[model samples]
Target: MGKATGFMEYQRLQEASEAPQSRKKHYKEFVMHLDDAQAKTQAARCMDCGIPFCNNGCPVNNIIPDWNDLVYNGKLREALDTLHSTNNFPEFTGRICPAPCEAACTLGIIKDAVGIKSIEHYIIDKGWENGWVTPQPAAVSTGKKVAVVGSGPAGLAAAQQLARAGHAVTVFEKNDRAGGLLRYGIPDFKLDKNLIDQRVKQMEGEGVVFRTGVLVGKDFPAGITNWAKETVSPETLQKEFDAVIIAGGAETPRDLPVPGRELKGVHFAMEFLPQQNKVNAGDKVKDQISAAGKHVVVIGGGDTGSDCVGTSNRHGAKAVTQFELLPQPPEQENKPLVWPYWPTKLRTSSSHEEGCERDWSVATKRLEGSKGKVEKLIACRVEWKDGRMQEVPDSEFEVKADLVLLAMGFVSPVQPVLDAFGVDRDARGNARATTDGAGCYKTNADKVFAAGDMRRGQSLVVWAIREGRQCAREVDAFLMGESVLPR
Candidate 1:
């Protein structure tokens, strides 16, 4: 929809990044974005596929072709509006999302897909620079109140939508600030904290209330109370608000159990990543865990593991090695069979490009240490056959390791919060809530609902935002009898 034959003439181009040598010296964003003209040319790569699979691929269903055409035609303002119509935070998705839309692009069958994510970043950044992004306060007030229990992307999206639907929305965060994982879990080099602060300010201007350091549950633990600036029980919230949305993210991290698991040098990925982020935010940390001058081994080959790799390089570690239990995926996918769907293929993140050794189909058998601190890892190579994994004979080996970080993902949202609200959980440990029509996002308890990772388990920020927005629509409808908010 951008240009009749633009896809045939142009190739996809993306932003450039600083050299690893230079970028590893600090923890800040190093990618260089395209200028206005370059961005428009990239937008021209969008083709008018009869059926746009890219729309279905996008979690928020962003109007990709329409905005691409607008940008290609040099209609910057309209492009931003169309882009924002479906997604609330293009900036976040642009920077962090895996860009499934690009994977589903019509041209991707034979040629490189449109640089949709880059264009998205350009459109939103340009919108901000030109003062196009502003608060859209609701014209009418419904006088209903909504209590959202998390300040992650999902919780924030839901709260913003409900507030714009004329409902009084208050977001409760257990951390010292809002933007849960965005504030702490993610590295600043990938997404700067200032971007989050900017959107938060805009949300405030739109009449959303943010209460940081507040926990919601019964008999709030004294330890948690001290951690938060304020505290409120679920009962208190039910008594005060018309409806409650539980959007807290999955906080129970999966752990690696083996010999020397209690070693002093071993830490969870969450524990390691957040300290660096807090330090970047000007918070003082005593004797911060330094990968510097040490051999670091990161277990779990997901985004969290990649994050550890990047941070370790930034810390000037002597060596960094990442381990994955599954076998390595194909370097490229067979497009004919996997088109329009996310496929099983190797993905190399920018963090991977920074520098680190990656190994797959290997399992850690145990940890070895002295003085109660991790000193090495005993590992074995495994082979997959008949849908089961078996260790290869004589493949057992040991590698020196001064520090170990487990990035095995999360099991579920904190149990106490779910228990306090009396919401049922699925077999996988996620809150039991469906996204379909009729009782969408509704929890087992009356006047209670669930969304985001808490309801769906670990997922991308884009998916979380989508669920949050859809859940808000359901909550608004339940409170006001009907809702105009988009799902």
Candidate 2:
């Protein structure tokens, strides 16, 4: 450890951020990464815990202590190297990942967890500023070709690994851009699109090829956010590539099937989110869904719902309200009972801090409107018993809502893509693939593998990257009968 008793000497320092009133005026990242001295102090608080549960707590198993020590010692380049060893895109995770690793920190059992995510953000950003992050093309060509479906984190990580292993890799994306959900699903304020572009350039330099606006499947359903001008058949990829990895995000959003689901001005979070991202990228969208001047209601209590709240506020909505079907969790967790494990607790996002009316234990009954446009939402408060929910007597209420966004999260991958590949799907409609054993990540379909959300259903980006890297190892071994790539 860099400083044995640093934890006792120094206190945690949170990153600076733009004030709510000012940051709400524009769509730029408000949170600033810690400067060098601040990061070093934060890193020194690692406490030299014997068992680094924070490593396993992270989906990608980042070597937290080593990097923390490196950061504390002012070895910026080595810290960046250690970070990149486990995470292909720390920049993405640093900005968006919920940091379960912090929750699992041994120090968190007593005092505040080490500012691990902040240190990571600082390391990666410094790496870029100093040109430490660059292409790592393999020394020798393996002469194998790999195809990765979707250009989201999982696909991007897989492609980068496979390419660096000296195999030619091509990533196909249905959208006009390569970032999948990262470039479109997340708001620009949270993550700038240029970061995705920067990574794409670096990957291209490392011999990974990206084919945007190219759909691997025959077709996707309408309203699924496809911008493909051309479609490539799954059979063609199977013939051309030595291995194929299905790494698309779970695109099928869980719907609120109320009586007035067909009403206008009521849309899934995906439909609303991507449009704003496109607009931010200077692309004009016809009849784009806007929360401007409307009383907006967002359903669901996850990141997507929080994103809706932020975007609605940016769009200058009259009012914004968020609803959660489940009861709110405790504000704080009992660390003794749940140490080293992610605990269920109340989380208020930056969007909530910006401003939002939040309610829990509420379920929407229906939408009401005239002329086919949603006008109000009818809902009821409920009580839970034994994992079952029952509405409270006479608790029904209605709220004025000119715009309703359903952000309840995704259920599974788009089924058509799986059907086109002729791969088996699990009960939840994700591509059926295991993460372990001799045939791990491999589907029943020949030469086809699955990873990330496409196989695991809706999940965090870190999990996606983890699966992508592991899947790459499996695909590499499958191709050459052995692989040296990290699992």
Candidate 3:
């Protein structure tokens, strides 16, 4: 610990955010990082907890205390090194991670949790500014080739690690750009696309090849979000590469199959989100779905739904409303009951702060429309008892909705890719693979491995990076009979 009494002496200070009214006018990052002195003070607040639950709390198991001490002592480069030891991409996580590590912070038991996320954001941003981030090309050639499917966080991490382990790695992306969800699915306001480009350039310098707009599968179905300009058969990869890793993420979004789901103006969050991201990147899109001057209704009160709300507000919508079928969680979690773990509580994002009418315990009965265009939503209040939901009598209501966006999360990875590889699938439709023992990350098919959302179903980016790093180690060992890559 840098300062034994630092936690007692300092109160938690969050990063400042742009005014919602002003920020909603443009699709750019509004959160401002803490200056050096403030970051040092925040880092000093890390308590001398023996267990360091935050390490376990973080999906990538970042060495929080060591970096906190280093930052507090003004050893900026040392802090960055300690950070890079566990996590491959702090810049991505620092901006988007929910910071479960802070929830598990020991100081959170009695006072506010240490601002670990802010400190990380500061450290990585400083590292980039100081030209500390650079290519770490392999020292020797292993004379092996690896193929990574998908260009999301998991695929990127796996490719980088495998390349650095002296193997030729090529990443194939179905999209026209490198980043998967980060490039399209996410709004540009939270994360700038240039950050992804910067990392991709560095990875290329480290001997990793990125093939964008290249789909590595066959029998591509229409209506599925495939941006591939060219298709490469799975057989080609199996023959050309020594090992193939499936990191193509969970792309099959869960659908709302109620009546009138076929109505026009109702779309998946993916379809709506990617268009805006593309537009932000200065790409022209035809017949783009616009929320401008429409009564927008977003279903599913999750991160995706929140993103819809933000985008809708930016488009100058007439009104925006969000719906959740589940009951609202408590405003504050019981710390004694759920300490050192992620707590369940009400979470209001910056999008909600901008403007949104949020409701819970409501389920949509059907979407009513005129001339094949959605006009309104029929909903009803419901009660959950004995694990069963029953609609409340006489609680049906209707809300005006010109455009409806379904953001109810994803169900599984796109099955065609997995099928093309002949990989077994779990009951949940993720690629079936183990994460322990001798066959960790290895799929049922020979010379093929799975990791990240493709194997674990949709999850956090940090978890995807962890799985990617671990999967790379397993793949390396499988190739060379042993590996020095960390688990």
Candidate 4:
């Protein structure tokens, strides 16, 4: 605790954001990080809780109090070191992760929680600015080779750790670029693509090879996002590498199979999102899905849906509306009952602030259109009782919708990759692998392991990194019969 009385003396100050009206005009990050002094003040708010719940709350188990104290004492380099110890990509989490750590903070039970995410953003940005972040190449090279499939957060983290452990690592990505969701799924307005590029350059300098546009399984289905210019067989990887780790994330999106789902204007959120990211990166897409001058209806109330709202606004849509089948949560959570744990509460994203009409407990019945183009949506209100939903009588309604984006989240990993390698799948269709025990991360198949979203199903980037680091340790031990890498 840098300042025992800091909480009483200071009020929480959030990082400033550009006005929605102005920020929506361009596809760039708008939230400004706190300056050094402000960050120090924020860090000082960390209390002397006997057990730091915030640490446990974070998926990667970051040492929050230590870093907060370091930042409060103006030890910028020390804070950055502490942050990097737990999180391989704090820059990504700082920008995008919903801070469950803050929700579990002791201070949040009474007053506002410490602005940990903002402080982390400041620390990492400062580290980069001071040229402190550089490749840490291994001192000696091991003869072993490892193959990491999917260049998302999990694969990248595993590759970095395995390479630093003196093993040869090669990452294969289906996309033309390194980052998976970070490069394409997320809008540039929240995260800049250059940050991903910067890390890729550093990883390359550390002896980790990145093979972009290389698919490692059967060809992906049409309308699914794929930028692969070459295909590599799973058998080849198993034969060439000492071990193979699958981190290809859950790519099968959940679909609404109601009437008129085949309409031309209806698309999955993934189908619409990646195209805009490609356009932002200066690639010309043919017949790109545009929301311009249309009444857009985004189904599913989640980050992906919010992203659609933001992108639609940027596209200068006539109107934007979001729908959620579940009932709305309370605006404020009951802290007394849910302290030190993530609570159910309403969250309003920056996209909603920009412009969006949001409704909850509403379900779509069918879409009506002509000439194979969606024109309107038919929906009804629902009531939930005893964990079951029933439609409300005489509550049917219709709304104009020229474009419908289904952002209802992913169901499981794309099955073809798992089939190609002959790995068993969990009941949920994710790659089956335990996170603990002697065979942790090892799949049913020999010399193959699974981690991140591929094994755990779709999850946060922080969880992906954690799984990656742990899987790397397991793989290293499998290769050398023991491992010195951190868990």
TM-score of each: 0.97, 0.99, 0.99, 0.99
Model 4, runs deviating above 4 Å: none
Whole-model Cα lDDT of every candidate shown, in order: 0.89, 0.94, 0.93, 0.94
Tens digits of per-residue lDDT, candidate 2, 40-122, equal 99999999889999999999999999999999999999999999999999999999999999999989988999989999999
Q: Could you tell me the TM-score of candidate 2? A: 0.99
Give the lDDT ranking, best first: 2, 4, 3, 1
Candidate 4 TM-score to native: 0.99
Stretches of candidate 1 off by over 4 Å are 218-227
Model 1 global lDDT (CA atoms, 0 to 1):
0.89
lDDT of 2: 0.94
RMSD of each: 1.8, 0.7, 0.8, 0.8
Q: What tens-digit string does per-residue lDDT give for candidate 4 at 1-487?
A: 9998898888899999999999999999999888989998999899888789999999899999999999999999999999999888888999999988999898898899988899889999999999989999999998999999998899999999999999999999999999988888899999999999999999999999999999999987655689999999999999999999999978899999999999989999999999999999999999999999999999999999999999999999999999999999999999999888889999999999999999999999999999999999999999999999999999999999999999999999888999999999989999999988898999998799999999999998889999999999999999999999989
Which is the better candidate, 1 or 4, if ranked by TM-score? Answer: 4
lDDT of 2 at 468: 96
